[model samples]
Target: MTDIPLEHVHVAPDDGADSEPAPAVFVLHGRGADEEDLLPVAAELPDELHVVSLRAPDPLQGGYTWYELDLSAGGLESSQPDAEDFRRSLDLIVESVDAAVDAYGLDADRIGLLGFSQGAITSLSLLLEEPDRYAWVVALHGYLAASYASLDPDGIESKPVFVGAGAGDRVIPESRTTAAVDRLEDVGADVASGSFPGGHGIGPQELEAVVEFVAARAV
Candidate 1:
């Protein structure tokens, strides 16, 4: 399970140094999306970033999802995310990150995480549980899972984060979105955020902010 299916995008170093370790970003796609879904976003990011996108372990309807969502009550809820599956997926992500660092000779301290929807939830969960492994995070159109509500501030305080959502997103209600941001801020994460005037997906303005967020953290 640790050997996650991956698609790699190598960006050439501008300095022309053969051995200089370039910064890296692990791109996580939304529910029912594949590894290729976020590759374009990676391309728009700063050049020379080693991008590693992973496919979710569980196969869903026609694509992939990180975890199972129980919306039996007609509300967007994930109070139960297949605990065993989540553990396995989370473990694989950590293992993959470490392996990627070793194989590419990349600086672990410079690695950032970018994700959307379910991907975003996993990214935030991983960061909250294991903050030392990543430098920053960009979580789009997602909320903090109920399981991770009691995150310890000591482990993640001062961590850089960019959390964005759509004002018209019906899938994740505004209340949940607001709570997600408030949770992160209460935990002392350096949170920079924006809301787009759209639905349950990312938009141009959000992408622009993402670019700026990545650039600022890349330094």
Candidate 2:
């Protein structure tokens, strides 16, 4: 059995660079989804990226989840992640991505992260908790978890980040996404953020922006 922490789909670069170790992008799916959900996004990325889409550990309602929701605050818009599960998922992803650097012959310094919904929340968490590990980040329809409310910004200076949210998002309100963007900027990260016209999903325009932002920096 493989030692990688999470279930994953790895797509090698279509037009690989003329080098031994390839750059990589880790794709994390939204809650109630599996590793396969975001493969199409990977296809649109630079051909030089070794894309790896991850499956969250906990299975839920015929799908998967990064962590259980803590909706004690009333509804989906006010929900938070269960702390224990969130931390565990973050640890597993960190381990898996680190291992992948060796297992897949990836360039460690060129690693990127992309996620949606719950996955997006986790992506932001990862970027904050271990900012030096990731070279770039794209988080969609997600917010900064409460646990990282006071992260030190010294390590992630000028880190590149892309955040997306739907103007009509009921699942994860655009306000939350904006808060995440604001925090990233406060921490001195170079962030590019936008709002779409749909509800809790990646529209074409947002998708194009994600593609462009990553393509420019991932190179």
Best by TM-score: 2
Compared with the true structure, all predictions reach lDDT values of 0.80, 0.91
Q: Which stretches in model 2 have alpha-carbon errors above 4 Å?
A: 16-19
Model 1 root mean square deviation, Cα atoms: 2.5
lDDT of 1 by residue, 128-194 (tens): 9888778999999888877798877465889999998888888775566678889999989989988
Provide C-alpha RMSD values for all models, in order. Answer: 2.5, 1.3
The best candidate in terms of lDDT:
2
Estimate TM-scores for all models.
0.90, 0.97
Which ranges of candidate 1 are over 4 A from the true structure? 1-17, 72-74, 77-80
